[model samples]
Target chain A: MGLDNVTVKPHEKLATALAPELTAVNTLIRERMASKHAPRIPEVTAHLVEAGGKRLRPMLTLAAAKACGYDGPYHIHLAATVEFIHTATLLHDDVVDESAKRRGRPTANLLWDNKSSVLVGDYLFARSFQLMTECNSMQVMHILSGASATIAEGEVLQLTAAQDLATDEAIYLQVVRGKTAALFSAATKVGGVIAGADPKIVQALHDYGDALGVSFQIVDDLLDYEGTGETGKNVGDDFRERKLTLPVIKAVAKADDAERAFWVKTIEKGKQDDGDLEHAIALLKKHDALTETRVEALDWAEKAKAALTSLPDTDIRQMLSEIADYVVARLR
Target chain B: MGLDNVTVKPHEKLATALAPELTAVNTLIRERMASKHAPRIPEVTAHLVEAGGKRLRPMLTLAAAKACGYDGPYHIHLAATVEFIHTATLLHDDVVDESAKRRGRPTANLLWDNKSSVLVGDYLFARSFQLMTECNSMQVMHILSGASATIAEGEVLQLTAAQDLATDEAIYLQVVRGKTAALFSAATKVGGVIAGADPKIVQALHDYGDALGVSFQIVDDLLDYEGTGETGKNVGDDFRERKLTLPVIKAVAKADDAERAFWVKTIEKGKQDDGDLEHAIALLKKHDALTETRVEALDWAEKAKAALTSLPDTDIRQMLSEIADYVVARLR
Candidate 1:
């Protein structure tokens, strides 16, 4: 199936199977967003939450829990917890990146102020903790809390690594895990744990989520370089921010001295303009970094699919495998 | 002995009692701060953690737990959790206030960058959540999470209240509870809960900590107007920032048309200069707002002492009562 079809099929089945749970999570999100003391919090949070981005993180949690035969009510709470954390990170990320847009909408920092974004993000984080506490499971709490710490560490790593061409693959993995995959892995892992799944099943869910998250982020990074008119984000978004993603890191590793000087001047020294993007793309192409990045993304997708072997041969598991395929199929 | 005698005694006894636990917490803090991918994480965190502010929040947890007659290891972990949260909030607060000095040293934002401060603050918050999870106590997690939410809400409330002289007692109370008292209350309450204290004693500790925190913040506000000589903070600091503290609110409430116009011109409109500080102080004196504020602080201190009545008349309880007195006694 195509990527859109794959997403649509699973979402339809999952929504019908977990409609009540999904409703609870939505209610929790609204209730938690309300602030009697700081009206600016809801104002900024609603700007982002209500702006129509897909509830992917929460969906991941719900799907994982359901796939593991979860029959309890706490999954809804965990789903909301995951979404709150993702939203909180997004608010801070926009401020750190100085990005004007997110999900084709004006970011919270852009609509309000960085101050509002930062504080509201913090409010959401606290709210997530509160929600997780309601689950009354220390194992669930540990999983989510550890995920939050990893996400923050990853973001910090990304911030410090930006514009430094010497950043290695290990650092790149840590940054991507923090910036994207940490939440995904945590969301799915917590879902399984809350369901009281067997340790083996929980581990399988975790590995699946981690590989899927890595694949998703790699595709996003690749799209920033090689995606055409179909992808909403423009090419060279990372280049504009002087972000040292996998492609740039790979390209730099393969560059000659003269090309290295050009990158240093344009990216590190912030001397880039419109033509610099074209030159950077040309350099990436010459180094085959784009092709290598695509291969790595596919490799992660296959790894994600392989993890599903440990899961039961349910429709959900099949759909998850297809989802991995869909992520890599985006490159086509 | 009276509360005064307890004030003279250093916290060495409490620290000694809690040493082994505190060491574990310190180890956790250190381990959480480590980021192999980001060398700057430790560098930035060390600048704040090593700056040597009193570990008052953590100590509250330790003291409360010990006072409740519990011998458990989790209290130290919870103590560190509170400290981490407090430290994270301070880093963010400095960035929000654009503050240069904290605890007689340059703020992290000044030494590093606001970006680093912001990210590191986030890192600390995540680490705090992780630390709280280590306690494996849902009650402790709930208390800390609720406090964290309240704290964030209070900050945003303060941000909106800044320069608005019409901010009243009710709003000010919410802000003070969120920004200061919430953490204090949580820190102490978690101690009692972890010690398996009864609900009544837990409530007592919570009330005592809340009252003490309110008194402490109010005294800090009062000192901004009346303090001199090695307190180190500038006098009229609130006036310069146009902060609507208790004194400012009371003074504005009692203002005549002429004084109100002056306030509108100076504080609300941000037209204040060095001379405006003198005029504002003169207005405060004319309305006796300074005296009123001092009286309010004393009232809170009395309330704090009264809250301890439920506790057994032990030395630690007595010392806690005295600590409350010492907080407000600075005004006398």
Candidate 2:
């Protein structure tokens, strides 16, 4: 998985192909994150933005635009805008999740305080809005702003849904779309829209991003339950947090009266004992929830690849398609 | 200040003059704040937005647009946008300040949790951005977005500066402009921009809002020290929180060595015993900081009125000018 390996990861390959634009996006991010009056703005944002998080969302923006024959400088602005939105969400998410660590490092909230995280996150959101306006396209602004609304709405929805026994797959999908897929779809759709791509092509880019994001999130949830020790995520962290992820939701749905009582106590009542995690895992296995979740993630990844078929067959597009497939490949 | 009183407050008078537009703005606010997916959004927002905070900022938008002879329907949207921004900031502010009360009610963070407050605040912010984009003016978007950035930057600055005794009047002014004046100026400027008013008229509106907001905040800080029990803000709340308002800043500037040590012990170290707040107030009087601060507020109010003289001499304009005077009149 290293950069020099022959079988380099899809996201790294995409980053290599979009190197110059990625550089421009990084420069723009550095320049924009600086505040003339508040030195803390850069300090808080730098912890997350400069952390090596693969820059996947922004690269998708650059890749989507380049695949649609966009040669203008605005794509750089859009890429940086996407990253700013991403970083802003991450900052707020840490505060919401009360997270102590992000990207395997101490989170901004831990380093400064929840106050800095909340306010600096706001500063990034404002910065993102300002950057999008630079593109001078109302259509782009419309899509990004709409995406922002959906993202926040999804998060609020998840807050209620994550602790409820009544939450089914449909509600889970809504939460996933709001928290994850909205930005992904917006990132890709705005790229094509800015490139003056045909409506159909832009629609295809949006579909690809949406499916890929869903697949990415499902796999992330799955990995938390099915850790290989290489992913850096502590297994059963979500369970300890009482968050009803896809696997737990599925297992609960298939639970009998006694198993339902277990879930009710552990999740809803939050009265789990030491062996409860082990019992939860056993129940997930008994119902084959992990396998079913993997199948769904793979299906979404396939849909993501299929949507990109209508895009130009450039190297960037090829890497994007592979990136979608790779998103769920870890499930194997 | 009651509606039927002939001596109705200036804001109430302005509200009477713009009743139809204000009604429309409320409708837009209610309509936009309700979320189809996240019921928590409306729940959390209604607790604050409907908590009777006077709607001063949105009223300014309506007044600015109507005074510029604009009869467009978009002012409703602009006014709603302003309120949404204000409400969103309040939501976040409560969480950042760890406040339990806002507008004489338990904060959303108290009723629900910090997570709900953070996410719902984000939703309102995103919703405001979407509402502004509907106005279809690049200039309006630029101004509002820039204000959002400034508001956040000022908040971050205040986070660091509030406890630092070295913070001067210049820094306090910058913080006030960011947290209050930025939105006020943007609210009024966008009204003029949406109305197709001349550049000079727009500048006047900007100036009026800027001065009014500064005066509004200065008087607010003054009330914290000279509380008549009518302001609803707890006297010595700012002192207890170690917030460095204008009077304290002035007093610190004129402090002797022992006075400086008292400020450092209370504000910098957050160590205070009984009568510390009383001593702080006494020091403020000893330095004549309260009188000086009151004079500055009156000066800003005068400037606010002076700026509005360039606009149309309508009843709405007269009410707006009166509102400016009434802001600082509480000091008398």
Shift of residue B223 alpha carbon in model 2, Å: 1.3
What lDDT score is found at residue A299 in candidate 1? Answer: 91
Residue-wise C-alpha lDDT for candidate 2, range A1-332, written one tens digit per residue: 21223255777888888888899899999999999999999999988888888998998898899999999999999999999999999999999988887767888999999999999999999999999999999999999999999999999998998779898999999999989999999999999999999999999999999999999899999998998766766788788778888999999989999999999999999898999989999999999999999989988988998999899888888888888867876665
lDDT of 1 by residue, B20-123 (tens): 76677678777777776677889988777767666777888888987898787888788878888998998888877778887778888899877888888888
Query: What CAPRI-style quality would you assign to candidate 2?
Result: high
The candidate that wins on lDDT is 2
TM-score for candidate 1, residues paired by index: 0.94
RMSD of 2: 2.4
Query: What is the DockQ score, from 0 to 1, of model 2?
Result: 0.92
Clashing pairs in 1: none
Q: Rate the local accuracy (lDDT) of all candidates.
A: 0.84, 0.91
lDDT of 1 by residue, A180-291 (tens): 8888888889988998889998998888889989998999998998888466666777898888899889999998999999889877887897688989989999999999
What TM-score does chain B get in every candidate? 0.94, 0.96
Report DockQ per prediction, comma-separated.
0.73, 0.92
